[model samples]
Target: MKADPKNVLVGSHYLDGNHACAEGAIAAGCKFFGGYPITPSTEIAERVSRRFPLVGGVFVQMEDELASMGAILGAAWGGVKSMTCTSGPGFSLMMENFGLGIMLETPCVLVNVQRGGPSTGLPTLPGQADMMQARWGSHGDYEVIALAPDSPQESFELVIHAFNLSEKYRMPVLVMTDECVGHMTEKVIIPPAEEIELVERNYTDKKPGEAWPYEDTKNLLSPLLPVGKGYKFHVTGLTHDQRGYPIINDEAQEWNVRRLIDKVTKNVDDIVWLEEKDVEGAEIVVMAYGITSRVVQPAIAKAKKDGIKIGMIKMVTVWPFPEKRVKELADKVKALIMVEMNYGQVFLEMDRCVAGKCQTYFVGHAGGTVHNPEDVYKTIKEAVK
Candidate 1:
């Protein structure tokens, strides 16, 4: 279906990443937003608050991040495409219910415009420190899909992709962008409504007695039955049967949890997206994502100029970590170099994936800003030697 033109900002504009993300949500047909303002992320909420009303959508400023997360989940179950935005401190507050959203199979989008920190570290600064936390922050054994946008334009595009993936898989999806990218201004072109493809929630067609929220489909994605639709359905965070009833046993535990993990893992190739440049026959591969990916380009260029056959893989999807592809590249490259704002979080994943196949090195910066290109270049040189 084409987007409603009124909600689509169909033109070129110099937009900051946070505002661009809000426009992306609007273009993607998101009708409800619940968020608590936090630095490096408040622009998203402010934009949504002003724009939602004009588009016949709703925006709520919840009491806190916890309430914000809860509100979006409630909105999703009410048959609306919903989202929320936050920084690290607020992101941390949302984790408990984030797990609940996962267990209940809610389809919504959450944007984390990452800031420096263990706790309120640097609100007005950049940090890629939340990459690992995005995967493992919530308690439990479920997998999630996360996309990292490197620029304001990609921020506009990827948030739409996040929503599409969430609806298709019946789970929450995250746009894991950092403050540098979130606040950076760039040109974002929103295409015509018909040109922008979107995935609608696959609502179940079964009668009230036959519809079950957790019913198994061959593809592992059960269609959702929104409340007040005359459907006899149950939704819970407990270990549940196909009928969505609480079941306490090892059998039920494996039955429910495995499906949640498998749905993402089994189809990882389809879920992972990447941009590779000159990887073939390269001695070193530099892996980076979010704003760091942009920062590392000049370094990669310098390495190439200095006769180093250094390649790069700019991560578009960070979670369900492109294990197969990384393993494949690991087997071929002489060494792998990871550069990020955080202190080696994703670098550890690269090391594990390499697994003695090749050497691995990490260049971690403690996030007030992006890496110095010379530092990234120096690391690539060291890795190759």
Candidate 2:
């Protein structure tokens, strides 16, 4: 479906990643937003607060991050495409409810504009440290789709992809953008509303009493019915049967949890998005994502000029890990280098996937700022040697 013309800012404009993300949400038919303001990510909420009302959407600044997440989940179930944005401390507060969204198979978007942190660390600085947390923050077993945008333009494009993926997979999707990308300004060209495609929620056709909300379908996706639509459905975070009713048993546990994981895992090829370059006969492959991907381009160019055949994989989808592609590259490349603003969170995953097929190295920064290009260049030189 094309986006609503009234909601699209269809022209060239200089935008920061936060504002670009807001425009992306509006263009993707997201009509409801609930978020608590936090440094680095507050601009997204602020932008949405001003823009949503003009497009017949709603923006609610909740009392806390917990309520923010909860409200979005409710809004999603209430037949609105919903989202929330936050930074580190607030991201931590939203975890349990994030899990609830997953358990109930609610489709929504969560944007974490990452900052340096264990607590209230660097509010205004950039960090990619939350890469692992996006995968494992919520308790229990389930899958999530997360995209990392390297620039304001990508921040605009990828959040729409995030929402589309969320609706397609029937799970909470995450945009794991960092403070640098969120704050950096760049030109973003929003295409005409007719050019923008959106995925609408697939509603169940069965009447209220005739259908189960969580009924397993051939596509591994269940249709959702809006509340007050005469759908007699129960939604809960507990282990439940296909009927969405609690069922406490080993069989029920395996049935419910396994599907949650497999929904994305089994459909990984469709969910995984990566931009690869120069892979054929390359001795070294530089794997990076988000802000780090942009920062490493100069280093990669330098490596090539110095006669090192270095390939690059810019991860667009951060979660679902792209293990198969990593393994394929591991077999061909002599060494793999993972770069990021965090201290080797995704690097560890790369190493795990490589599994002794080739040498794996991590180019990590502690994350108040981006890595120095020279340092990354030196690492690439070292890897080639």
Candidate 3:
């Protein structure tokens, strides 16, 4: 038996995207789920609320997404691995506190099952339009982890990784799905519960009163204890010192701010995630992610059969932008093509990462529609030449 990540002892079952996500969060050892009801993604909240009660986990439907996001932040520092799910509009509503989570360095999961949007453009339709927003929606400078899954099964396992990465890095992890995957039915074989790798927040093993509220432990991740516990720690949105107290002085601000940013940006290598295919000997490379990657699979296969040296890179973790891989490929490939459901979102990141190492092409079809594989085939084939 494999012993690295640990297997989940739970049994596998057929479940939809929404419920499968819930099961994944549960298997990840999430004991707190909070959110407001939003279409397409509403089933996620409903399923969590229903199942959470059965496992002694806590679930609450807040008056709005604002409260839902805030509740999850509090729950995380309060010492429970927590999550909140919403769609485009609700995700927008949660943005304010999402920023607060960044300032406070809260570790939690924010699942956005995306819908067409600038402002609720299509509630029941699918869109990958939120990709850029997930990284920059919140104000001030901070790094975010965004995971885009093509299927229900990937969504399940990705959420578990999202939570683990969030806690491990002390940053908010964003799970970006879409209306298509959220409501679509699919066969997801669960990994046994015991196989799951769970990372809980580091609470002090010292006697209750002996731990420092924020002693600046290793990795800048302080020892965290539950709220009701006797250890007293202050969590604030303002720049804070090692002791968890607000620090507004310039020098103090610099130190505090640097630590907050370094905790993530300084470790970009460990945070990047992607899937590469036929990349070993390729003249043209297609950079695709989320559901769009699935659309381009056939194009890649066809190109390969015809002796076209074309490759594909599927981004599983969208944010932190896969900088290293993008830079390396930009230097090596003849040209790079980025296909997505949004106009030039990931394209911009690729361009920035490339910095003129190679020509970059972007193909996008927004508002719940996508480009055909033939279109992608033509684009990549042209790019190869």
Candidate 1 vs candidate 3, TM-score winner: 1
Error of 2 at 133 (Å): 0.7
Question: By how many angstroms RMSD does model 3 differ from the true structure?
Answer: 2.6
Model 3 has how many clashing residue pairs? 14
Per-residue C-alpha lDDT of model 3 across residues 1-385, encoded as one tens digit per residue: 1212222325556677888788778777777888899987998888888777667689998999999999999888877789999999898899889988877777899999988888869888888899888988977777788998888888888998898888887767899988877876788887655567678676678766676555667677666656777766676788778666887888877877777677777677788788998887789889887778888888888888888998889999888788888888888989899998887888899989999989888878775765688888888778876
TM-score, every prediction? 0.99, 0.99, 0.93
Model 3 accuracy (lDDT, Cα): 0.81
lDDT of 1 by residue, 242-317 (tens): 8899999999999899999989998898899999999999999999989999999999999899999888999999
Per-prediction CA RMSD (Å): 0.8, 0.8, 2.6
User: Which parts of model 1 are misplaced by more than 4 Å?
Assistant: none
Q: How well is each residue in 1-385 modelled by candidate 2, as lDDT tens digits? A: 8788998999999999999999999999999999998999999999999988779899999999999999999999999999999999999999999999999999999999999987999999999999888999989988888999999999999999989998999999999999999999999999999998999888888887888888898777998877897776898899998999999999999999998998999999999999999988889998899999999999999888988888899999989999999999888989999999888798888899999999998899789999999998988888877
Deviation of model 2 at 318, angstroms: 1.1
Ten-residue segment with the worst summed lDDT in candidate 1?
1-10
Q: CA shift at 82, candidate 2, in angstroms? A: 0.6
